[model samples]
Target: MASQEKIKLVLLACGSFNPITNMHLRMFELARDHLEDTGRYKVVKGIISPVGDGYKKKGLVEACHRLEMARLATESSEWITVDDWESQQPEWVETAKVVRHHHAEVLSSENNSNGDDVDTGKYRKRRKMEKKSPSCMNPKADRPHLNLLCGADVLESFGVPNLWKPEDIEEIVGRYGVTCITRCGSDAEKFINQSDVLYKHRKNISVVREWVTNEISATHVRRALRRGQSVRYLLPDSVVRYIQDHSLYSAESEQKNAGVILAPLQRYSKTE
Candidate 1:
């Protein structure tokens, strides 16, 4: 499905990058290596959908700020590309449409089109733009063999993608692939069971097991930030500093447990 214009792949990560952390980068790093080891080699495909902006998830600054930071955080990595599509989508659609978009492109080739009506010169430029533009060029799948990345909690919430429905998620995952960096034991099972329904794409649902990031959590980093302690070992240093720079969960809150602070806010601040 590739043309002389561009070589594309999707490396997806979904989460409340509430302010992305180092663990997030580490996860990506591991993801690339894991894919290479398996011979897929295009490990650094690109992030399809990422989580950001919510009430209880109360992003410290805002989505735009978070997106800028993410751009800065992964600016240096060739393998990383941000799909701000999810954050920008008003009602985030199922990841399947995005996956289907990729697949459609793959299923169809650029030059494969019938050349009867179109001018050759304009067509060449349009094909060029398709490679560089982040937006889907064709109405079909660009890279149908999509793989989504997420943590244990997000993986556990796989069934709940219904929250975004009438957009079906399981069907979407069935179309592409589900690559998870697992934490919870239950989600590991859920990912497997869900694959059964997707018998067609079962091989695509792969797990990038993590013994390294097992204990990493955004809530934990937020707690450390509030205590004015070093969260150096937790999230990415860039992320820690970004949180501090923005005064997110800083010592001013005097709240030791981030969960308590975020939870009571839901009960106390109904307008949120």
Candidate 2:
């Protein structure tokens, strides 16, 4: 029997990433393991997209810092990378829009890599030259699919009043699909059953249960930093150094942004 072809997919984790933590990086591995275990999907890449400053969430640091910290955290990961597009936006963009943009980006990259644009119009000539080459496979066969990666809290947040739009949810879950990593208390199944949209497109959603409980929360990390406590093991050493060098999340930093109105979006929470 011939080996089954897997769907090429990229996992996109969008969050505030106020300070990328160990658990944040682990989520990608957990999701990849679960997806590959099924032998149906191949996770070729993982992207961390930090929310822009326009999100207005309390304790949320500057986009530059968040983006750089995310980069520093994922530096050692071969397939994991940080994208600053979302954080570079002038305003808070919806999750669905972010997903759509990235999907297009992946497709564009795949096209370029597949020799679709070889020398502008010389693709035909190149194809003719390599007509007998076994490596010249159809690009569509390996077209990359982008999926939103999130915690169960984000799946449940679909029900939060006015926090997320219904159409956006449909586009995200229905179109690009979602890989929700289950947290201890988050009932991902219950939330899916409660929402008609999610239930309608349930097949596209993959609920990945994280067996090893990692309770590393950026919120708590911030609190520890503010209180001058140790957050060594909770976050990456480079990220910790970056935070210390920049004085981020300190009591003084908190005081400077004291008037920042906390939005319903919880920072570094399970939702992120």
Model 1: runs farther than 4 Å from truth? Answer: 1-8, 48-61, 90-144, 160-167, 184-187, 194-201, 250-272
C-alpha lDDT of residue 117 in model 2: 67
Candidate 2 local distance difference test against the native? 0.82
Clashes of each: 19, 0
Lowest-scoring 10 consecutive residues by lDDT in candidate 2? Answer: 130-139
Question: In model 2, where do residues sit more than 4 Å from their true spots?
Answer: 1-4, 118-142, 255-272
Query: Please, what are the lDDT tens digits per residue for candidate 1 over residues 83-169?
Result: 676567554334455555544443354335443233467655654564454233232433324466666565555444223332345
Reference-based TM-score, model 2:
0.86
lDDT of each: 0.55, 0.82
The positional error of residue 259 in candidate 1, measured at the CA in angstroms, is: 14
Candidate 2, 183: how far from true, in Å?
0.8
